[model samples]
Target: MIFNHFHDAYLYTLAEVYHKPQFYNQPRGNRSREVLNYTYGIESPIERICYVPERKTNIIFNFAEALWYLSGSNNLDFIHYYASNMSKYSADGRTLTGTAYGPKLFAYGDKRLNQWERIKEVLREDPDSKRAFLSIFDASEVLQLENIDVSCTIGLQFFIREGQLYMSSYMRANDAYRGMLSDVFSFTFLQELMATELGIEVGKYYHNVASVHIYETDYVQTKTVLSKAKQIGTVPAYPFPPMPLKDNRSDLQVVFEYEQQLRQGTITLKPVDIDRLDIDDYWKQVILLFAVYQSIQQKKVIDHTLYQKLIPLYQMLVQQKWESYFSIIMEEM
Candidate 1:
């Protein structure tokens, strides 16, 4: 079934997958796991683009992961800072061997042909081309015993139909409760970026997973989220502005630079610093949110005004649940 928002789609998938999970074994752990084969399509993939409140999705981690992929980085430091669990995926404890989709998309294999750049070039040359596929799974690395970080997503395919750009992502395996939200966030972000670069309207997104499952360890949490989904009521699709055609690469680069400086203690977090950024107002607000997150981590007082300004944006793009979540974050400080 097609859902208008990502949270609804995720909750629906979780409930269905949890109702009848099959016992199976995975490569990571020796214990038997519960899983299910599932497939679903999102009619408005980018609408209300955040996880359900019950799931307690980390906004910082989601945005940081998306930016990391776009930056073509494989360093554990970048992702580990936001999501500590990412460190476990590293094969040598230094770099992610094969599961790093960023490097694969922007600089893959020995020849280092940037798949994203290639996709843009192909689409620019032929808007209706069927060869606009970005491959992330590297069979050469997956076949080796030393490579432990194999990709879960096989590839992403883009199509241009009726003056819109549609994206379909294929995954070999998916953890319905733990992994699906972040995967969708990153992939759909990529889709929006591509559509913007191509100067076309964003279209529907299709996601197909060969194995979509919730582990036995997460059964209670899955059930809790499912139960809460009912009380959350039906969420309507939130309107989103069309992505601007002008390239925001330089603007994004500036954000990344500022983030790096803040992480390294070279620059102090301040609301005034956000005014120096040349990015769009929305991105400036997003950067400010990041700054607040950093302040929380550093035991500094959060700028309440920034958090207040960000609440409506998050509610519009994510969900109203974030309003309470952000309030809690601030209250604890």
Candidate 2:
């Protein structure tokens, strides 16, 4: 979205909105080395590719469609499974498990209202407030799912600037081109819906995925997405309208019921083609990475545990004496 520096744009979006202090209370450096990406140098997946062959807009939309299929479909199942697994509540907020039905509660209103409702509320509270923030950082829900197989949503963070909503998601892992593309599309749609609900005009929809690397095995799919992205010229815009709430109910039961009908006997989600992602537009992402790397280095206050692994790398990059060209490569990356 109209950024002075791509890195600035990316870091701002990645800012933490709601950090659960409990999760942050872990022992420092307990698992720092396990988190570092030292063996994987700058030339790894984090580096920017100069060229790709896909249409930008098509790639963005393809990812959007995939996200729609996932959110509208599996999200409810994730909620149900999580709720059933814990199935208990706690008197103290400290030990509150799934009994409170947080997953089921969050699934209501087509899964849009629960996620974007607070965003709209922030907008309505101050139509011109540039600092409107909201996030989906339900650790308890995610932990329950993690106990079984894998968690769905690692965490989400959103920010509003100049009437536009920007989002950033942090995950323990992602599917490079595929996951990043889908994430961008879904968050952009969510931004549009929140804007519509708040009665405000939509602006830019900025998005970022912290880890844009590839596994040794997924290189083939990753290369295909990159090649396709270079082929695409422009990114597609997803038009997501605001969801209608039934009598202002915040509970997720109604949403789950609707999902039940959508998923009759089998849950065959529409597959998102890897070719739909445009790699050329990802240049901005490369720019943002440099910026984040810089921020991590110059950061005087290092209080958060989430960024512990990045500190050493940040220190090394800062010593390189990188220059203004950092911003120029954004368009080329």
Candidate 3:
């Protein structure tokens, strides 16, 4: 597609430069007026670089890797490269499930769904809850990952305004062009699903990939993509209709009552947002709590293993001054 907006423009620039950068180096008089060429050309007397990447090649690989996997097409050689770098892949870490390395990465975005569930709960309670959010921006966890030479964020963020859900994924770096497509579609799906459950409309999608870097390799194609994003296109409607709730009570009287409501087709799930409660202060505690819960479910038995997971949660709660919440959870455990 032709780029119509800055976002698409940025992405196309990255892919083009990274994939095949030679075509874009042709100087447009070296006047520094053409931002794309002036910035991308290296050691070529270009004065200013508008979008210099923080971790140049890693950003390219980061976006490219996601794109490659999602395409469900394999670059067998690259897969071998990833596999060969086994020492760099953190096999021992808190991933959702399954094998280590790239296999686990494919699922990193999926676990963000846990946050989606909480946000949905909040919206159901009070649609205006400014507290609605979920973030996968876990620094310690990201740091522990061995294969993190590539600068990137481990967490993504989600928020809601009025009845609309908004998401901003914070990346330490990104190959903007290729990654944006997947990021947009995936988060949009999350927004639409949550909106349907809450009886609200999906609104704006705000994406922030901290560094939208176009490498020297993809300069030409990036320009092509920029032109594409600039053109207007209809935002596609979400696929599903509003999902209905089902009751599964086993007690005879309860079952009868539930069935009666089901037959009448009048039962509605009330959605609420609890954000106004000023629970933002407790966000770290909440996320860590969930993480700890996940760790426990993994059958971790060693005291140190348990302590490693719990200590961070403990420290985070202390830092947030939510000692009471921490104490309550500890007592319950």
Clashes of each: 0, 27, 38
| Candidate 2: C-alpha lDDT | 0.34
Off by over 4 Å in 2: 1-115, 128-131, 141-160, 168-172, 228-333
Per-residue error for 81 in candidate 3, Å, reads 16
Every candidate's CA RMSD: 3.2, 18.2, 21.5
Evaluate all candidate structures by whole-model CA lDDT and list the values in order: 0.74, 0.34, 0.36
User: Could you tell me which residue pairs clash in candidate 1?
Assistant: none
lDDT of 3 by residue, 36-147 (tens): 2211111111011112121121211222233333322323433323233523333443222111223322333445244545666776677666666554444434344344
Ranked candidates (TM-score, high to low): 1, 2, 3
| Best model number under TM-score | 1
| TM-score, cand. 2 vs. native | 0.40
Candidate 2, 212-272: lDDT as tens digits: 3333344454445444544543221212222332221222233233233323323211112
Global local distance difference test of model 3: 0.36
What is the per-residue lDDT of model 1 for residues 189-269, given as tens digits with 9 covering 90 to 100? 888888878878789998888888777788898888888778766574334433456677877887788777766657765
- Sorted by lDDT (best first), the order is 1, 3, 2
